[model samples]
Every structure is written in C-alpha cells, then in structure tokens.
Target: MVEADTTLAQVLRSNLMLTGTKIGCNEGQCGACSVLIDGKVVRSCAMKMRRIKDGATITTIEGIGTPEDLHPLQVAWIVHGGAQCGFCTPGFIVSAKGLLDSNPSPSREDVRNWFSRHRNACRCTGYKQLVDATLDAAKVLRGEMSIEQLQFMIPEDGRIWGTKYPRPSALAKVTGTCDYGADLGLQLPEDTLQLALVQAEVSHAHIKSIDTAEAGLMPGVYKILAHKDIKGKNRITGLITFPTNKGDGWDRPILCDEKVFQFGDAIEIHPGPPNVYFKQRVAKGEETEPLFAAAG
Candidate 1:
C-alpha cells in the first residue's frame, strides 16, 4: 500500500520519530524537509510517499551521519556554527551531503547554489559560516587531513563537542546508518485512508456550479466534501488575518463551495488507491501543466 499526499516531514516526524527533519512550512516553499532521494536533494514536503514507494531510497539527516560517527559535514556544521535553533540543521546537513557527494570539492558559489532552494534559516548562524564549515569538512572527507592533525585543530576550551576538527556523525551519515523521520515504520491502520486535494483550474473566479456527480460515482472516492459539509470551522489554521474578508478565513470549507479562491485551490478530496488517482491525474495531463507553467 503506497501513501499519497503524505508529506515526508510528517512521515519522518510522526511515523519514524525522526524529529530531526523539522517541519518549517509544511509546504514545499521551505527547505526544512530537504532530503536525498537517490542522491539528489528534494523537498520532502512536496513529495508524495507513494510516488517513491517502489524503489527510491531516501536519505534523511539521520541517515547521513550520527553523533558517534559523524559525517564530515556534521562536524563542519558544529564547528562552523552552521546549526542554530537546530530545526533546519538536519535538512541543511543532508543537502550539503548531497552536494559534496557529487562534487566532493565545491566552490563558494557552488555551496550557495546548493542551498539556493532552502529559504528558511536560524537566527544564530549565517550562510557564510555554513559554507566555510562545509569546505573544511570536505577537506577532511577527501583524506586531506590526518586524524591527528584533525584532532589538533580543536580548541583547548572545548566549546563544541565535535569541534576537534572531525564531525562525530560523518562516518555514519556517509555509510547510511543514520535514520530520520521518514525511515520509521508508519504502520498506519489497514483501513486508514489517504487523500489529495483536487483544486480549481480557474483563478480569481467565482464558482458557478460544481459537477461532483461524476466524481462521486468514481470507484474508490470515499467522500466529496463541499463547503456545506463543514460542521465545525472552515478557516485555515495559522492565518493571522482574513485577507479575502471571507468569513473567518475558516469560512472556506474543506472544499470550495460557490466561491473559488485561487487557481489550484482544493476543490475535491480523493480517497482510494493512490496510484490510480495519480495515474488518472497524469493521464488527464494535470500533472504536466504545472511543469509547463513553471517553464514558461
């Protein structure tokens, strides 16, 4: 059973108990959930668990390195103050690992671009420190530094734990022993249903009439929630102000009613074999539209 519309952050957090993968935005815009899928850094928030269920191997911060046998990147992160608030550290570490794994020796500009996709950060540290740390760690990983020399680089004050020049988790991270949120066994109930939002195609248009009769009759669709189906509150949580002047903002139901707020706004929730729904959407060319829009 593949899971669809399942955020990798949630999979890492709730299922695997890998609290390291922080859920910054719960949206793909933030790189907090960045992880390595087949050695490429990807945003976990936007990735559907079902899409990767077949054969893709995921690498989380934990998978990259560990405290006992840290990857060089982890060491760099600690010695260089690349981590602060520690929320975004895991994702950054994993991303850096992916970059270094491919490039081994990256320039400053390369480092910046490697992290270009990540917009979130901690107040304590800046990108320069992270870049410097990564460079140093790369030197160590590439066998440029001897263990004794690496140890000598440590400060006498011992302010940092892994600052002795080598990251404690570097080896573990590179070896793929560390585990993160998504690695845990989700083990959801057999009957537990998965859902995905089907949004409106038009932007800035009031919905005239919705034709759900055909969709509702589909084989595996459990329920089609409309604005009227909401019993409690319809507003989206975490919003400070209602911009649309639409009821409490929560007034928007789980599904759009007569008013469609924006293009790609959820109009329907599909529950069934995730692969089937995904295939159907792809077959209808909905999947390719976004790519074309982005390219244009």
Candidate 2:
C-alpha cells in the first residue's frame, strides 16, 4: 500500500527497495533523489504522488544499468569519476541521460547550463567532471566513438614521446574495468574470508610470548595464523644483493618466527573484513587521505 503524500523517492527506496536512488536535502535542493517520469528527470523527493498522471511511467537508477552490463554513461561515470557517492549520482545520471537523449551533441557550457537549469547539485564531484562525462557520453551517442575506444588515452600532439602500439591490457586499465588478482579472488563462488594484517608497531622488538587469546575470540574472526602454521621457509626471494647470493630464499618469512623484521612487517594476517579506507579524495578538490599497503 502507498501513502497519499509519499514522494517517488520514498516509493523507490522504501516501497520498491531501490536504494540506489539516494535521498538528500529532503526539501529538493539536492538532486540526490532524481528519477525519470516519462523520460524527463526530476527531483523525486519533491515529486508527490498526487502530481502524477494516471498512466505515467517512472524510471529510477536501477532502470539505468547493472554492474555486469552497464550503460555507456554508467561506464563514463566511472571513467570520468562523476558518480562518487550514491546520494547525488542517481539524480545526476538521470538528469544527464535526459539531456543526452534530447541533445546528442552538447558543448561543455551546454552541459553545465543544462545541469544548472535542472538543479542537479552534487557534493562529491564539483561540476567539471560531470560536464566532461556528459560530453563524452554525447560523443558515444552520436556514434563518433565506441565504448571500447574510451579506454584509449590521448597523447600529446605530433612528435610525441610515445608509441601507438596498443597495449593488450591498456583498455581495461583505462576504463577502470580491470579486475586485479584480489578482485578475482573476491569473485570466487564460495564465501571467501578477508585477511587483515596486524603489523608490528615498533621498529624492532625482542622475543616475547605473543598473546592472541582476546584477538582470536573477536567478532567475525575466523582464524589467527601463527609461525607454526607456515610450512615452507618464510621468505621473499629475488632480493639479490650479489651474484653469489643464490641459495636460500630466507629474506622475509610468510610469518614471523622469533623476531619482527621491520616496523610495519605484517606479523599476523588475521581473518577480517576488507577495503573500507579507500575513499581518497578525487581530482576536484576532494579531501586528501592516507595510503596503506594493499590486501591480497
């Protein structure tokens, strides 16, 4: 059952459970609650049920594309870094789609003006990326370029210090569609647990009785591996200081046996959750963030 005064945003999120349609600034100043009504984009939070016609058609973010088979604009959003947070992305995408549907060849100013005329305010990507993304999508729509060619990075003008021989993996990397080893591992069929490294804090440490009684019993922890669990000689080979240094691969161990090597050496990689601290700010004046070693 639908409420009398409930907005389209509410219906998409609360009723239909299309949580991609984000709600922000409920007064409609933010375009976070954007959706299409009869192919036109509008702020869903301000759109009341009473304002709709009898047979009106509506489309939300879910109607746009999926992760596997994304729309060109959706792909462009990732390439152009326009859709950072979901709050403004759905509305901005719908609004952009509406604009491109009507005007296939829009200038940068046209995109900027179109967004301004629609009140498509975004907090993450300022506005330049959005405009650039719209223009790129317009090119794709105008059949000037293919989706695969979007990955080709343009070099400088003539006599460039570069070669044109296409790298096999360049396209995927450029389009942000390449899945690394860890990504492939996460896509495994079975439920896979994550490994979070708890490194040694000090630069050096003396041998002492290690304790994991508390850490092992923490919530969501599956296993806490010690040195004994490692089968082979713990080492990171290929660190050849001299040509004669070719014997044992005992530089860094799979797990610390008696002493901690470095300050941040991963001593124990306990089972834990993954990748939440990756929100380093974007190009358009986003906040700076700390970098850390990647997970496997």
Choose the strongest candidate by lDDT: 2
TM-score for each model: 0.52, 0.52
Stretches off by above 4 angstroms in model 2 are 152-296
Can you write out model 1's per-residue Cα lDDT over 70-128, one digit (the tens) per residue? 67777666666565445567777888888889999899888888788555454556678
- Report the alpha-carbon TM-score of model 1 versus the true structure: 0.52
Native-to-model Cα distance after best TM-score fit, residue 238 in candidate 2, in Å: 43
Question: Candidate 1: where are CA atoms >4 Å away?
Answer: 118-122, 147-296
Instruction: At residue 47, give the lDDT of candidate 2.
Output: 86
For candidate 2, write residues 122-164 as lDDT tens digits. Answer: 8766788778778887888788989887643556554324643
lDDT of each: 0.66, 0.67
